[model samples]
Target: VNLLFSANRWEMASEIVDDLNRGIVVVCDRYAFSGVAYSAAKGLDFAWCQAHDRGLPLPDSVFFMRVEPQVGALRANFGDERYEDVDMQVRVRERFDDPRLRQGVPWH
Candidate 1:
């Protein structure tokens, strides 16, 4: 599944590059960082999770919206997905806060 996510990004590489070349800004809701963070939270090795996304175009800016786990759980449709549990979100948030994962990205 991680590979699939990376492949999905790779598949869009050409279009993304084209947009950049045309001076158009592109925004992605979830990029490679999310993949690594979520997978690492699920017990995958962090470095291994990051390996799959190596060489993908780096975003010019990254914004992380911090939300309390319980608060997030109260959001509408929060439980519709497999990883929506508050416990899982807490784990994922920890992973996202790791400085190693934020390296090289212009996080806001």
Candidate 2:
């Protein structure tokens, strides 16, 4: 398991998972799921996002935190912090609700 904050697609995650064939777990902060959400927010096809993540090592346990864009924006607000596009965040959150994204990795 690889930890990636702000998950991307499975291409990189799969590479990392494939690199480790031993009985050790690599902890990751984020993974392919992030890409699904972010890309979905961008109005990209959720299936396409998932397709890009195919063949990645599946996490034994997966968790998702359902959040609203406004909530996220408030929480992410920090002085001197680089800003994010709130609209994009909303789109990403919507993508998380996509059936494709809901399929794999039972959420905790």
Candidate 3:
């Protein structure tokens, strides 16, 4: 599933780059880091998650919104989908702090 997520992103790499080339602002709701975060939350090796996306085009910038675990679950409508629980969110949140990631913009 992680590979599929990465593949799905790669599939759209061209379009994203094209928009940038044309000076069109492209705001992706989710990107490569999501795959690593979600997969790592499932107990997969973080290194493997990253290796799976090696060579992918890095985004010019990314925005990561930090919220309390309980709030995140509530916002997720917890249980409506996988990884919506507080425990999983905690894991995902930690991985989001990976040093490989660049500074993220703030969002409420």
Clashes of 1: 0
Model 3 Cα lDDT, one tens digit per residue, 8-95: 8879888878988999988888877888888988988888988877776676667677888888666635778876788888888888
Query: How far out, in Å, is residue 54 in model 3?
Result: 2.2
Over 4 Å off, model 3: 103-108
Candidate 3 has its poorest 10 consecutive residues by lDDT at 99-108
| Colliding residue pairs in candidate 1 | none
**How far is each candidate from the true structure, as Cα RMSD in Å?**
0.9, 5.1, 2.8
Query: Global CA lDDT of candidate 2, please?
Result: 0.63
Compute the lDDT for candidate 3: 0.78
Q: 1 or 2: which has the higher TM-score? A: 1
lDDT of 2 by residue, 1-108 (tens): 112322444346656666567555676676677766776676666676566566767777667777776776676452234326677776767676767776757877
Candidate 2 runs further than 4 Å off: 1-21, 76-83
Q: Write the per-residue lDDT of candidate 1 for residues 61-101, one digit (tens) a residue.
A: 99989999999988999999999999899999999999988
Indicate whether candidate 1 or candidate 3 has the larger TM-score.
Answer: 1
Best by lDDT: 1
What pairs collide in candidate 3? none
